[model samples]
Target: MTSPHSKLHISRSLNRFQTQITIFLPRVAVSKMTVVHIVLIKFRPGVAQEHKDTVIQELNKMKEMDCVKHHRLVVGTSITVPVERSKGFEIALVSFHENAIELDKYRNSEEHLRITTTHIYPHQEESIRFDFEVAPEEEHLWTFLPIPAEN
Candidate 1:
């Protein structure tokens, strides 16, 4: 859902061809509208370091895909932050797409399927994913809440 606080506006401009065909979107939603995908993964016991490295390498390729607007992979850094519960997951993947269509493209892409099925899933014991839409300036608000499969 889009933010009620946001507004959509359209404007027209002349191009070099002197044609009157231009659409200008709202600065807030158009510039900041995004769908976010966050995945938390826990590797099974005794999973080798090489396997984990392969996951990171493969996940990095998602960033190079056209559908992804931004991507980041990070390892859990703290066990002492008592207020923050991670469910013992060790790795996280964060990605953003311009909209749901772009996100769906990324989800079904061959590059994603190849890595997760071949490299990462075999080593993981459990995984959690959260997908949400974030409107401009609504960082504290989430569109949906659930713990689902990372795929």
Candidate 2:
């Protein structure tokens, strides 16, 4: 049987270890949030279609960069679903970054700046941008009800 003094020492050591673990847990729990960048570009009136295509090509090249987790470049199309919204934006770019640090590097990259100024900015008359950190994916724990068939 352990003496009372030995038991107290063991208890104190365990408490110190638990305290150390509690202090370190936040760093592990608060993981980096994913960053998403969205851009909509409208070329100046009379801008050639070839120039527009080149701009898209340049944007697509950014996808190959290490900082970009995912990238998509798309031209806006006629609204098939009846949704009332502003029109005339010709192109949209959606990019996902692993985290804010990666996105900041991508924003200041030489290729991005060069392509924007030389290939895209001069031809584009209007631009829209949105950036946000995406919410973490949640586990699908709830059951879903069956949908009724439309008659």
Candidate 3:
């Protein structure tokens, strides 16, 4: 039979072990807030249809990235104004990851590099990227633009 003192000691050890386990387990706490990233991509002018298709296909794959909270791709139409006329960037906007870290991951992602090098660079006459940080209040504004449907 175990002595009372020994039993008490064993109980203490088990409690400590349980506490350690609880402390180390990953928590699922939600982020109180998030950052926003507005990415503007200018593709090379006069890019071939095949190249554009490939780039779009690669960009569409970004939706599958774990770090991407939201993703949207917009092509510049005649109504859109170029940020720089000399460079001739056909506008494209990519919205992803509300966190800067996640955005960094996205920038360094293999898929992103692959798309740029394989499809964008080969067909692009010139390309540029712009990144903007957005506040919580301004988040909805990005999606608030009015556009008429084309026939």
Best by TM-score: 2
Better by TM-score, candidate 2 or 1: 2
lDDT of 2: 0.66
Tell me the alpha-carbon RMSD of every candidate: 14.4, 16.7, 14.4
Runs with alpha carbons beyond 4 Å of true place in candidate 2: 1-31, 70-86, 138-151
The most accurate candidate by lDDT is: 1
lDDT of 2 by residue, 58-145 (tens): 8888888788874433334335344335456777887778787678668767678778878878888898989887656631222245
The runs of at least 3 residues in candidate 1 whose Cα sits more than 4 Å from the true structure, single-residue gaps closed, are: 1-32, 70-84, 137-151
Question: Mind giving the per-residue lDDT tens digits that candidate 3 earns over 1-151?
Answer: 7333311111112222532111222334434344454444455555666666666666777777777765543443223445355344453646557566577667666666666666666766655566656667766776655668999
Off by over 4 Å in 3: 1-46, 72-87, 143-151
**TM-score of each prediction:** 0.61, 0.62, 0.55
Compared with the true structure, all predictions reach lDDT values of 0.68, 0.66, 0.55
Clash counts for all predictions: 0, 0, 2
> Which of the predicted structures, 1 or 3, would earn the higher lDDT when compared with the native?
1
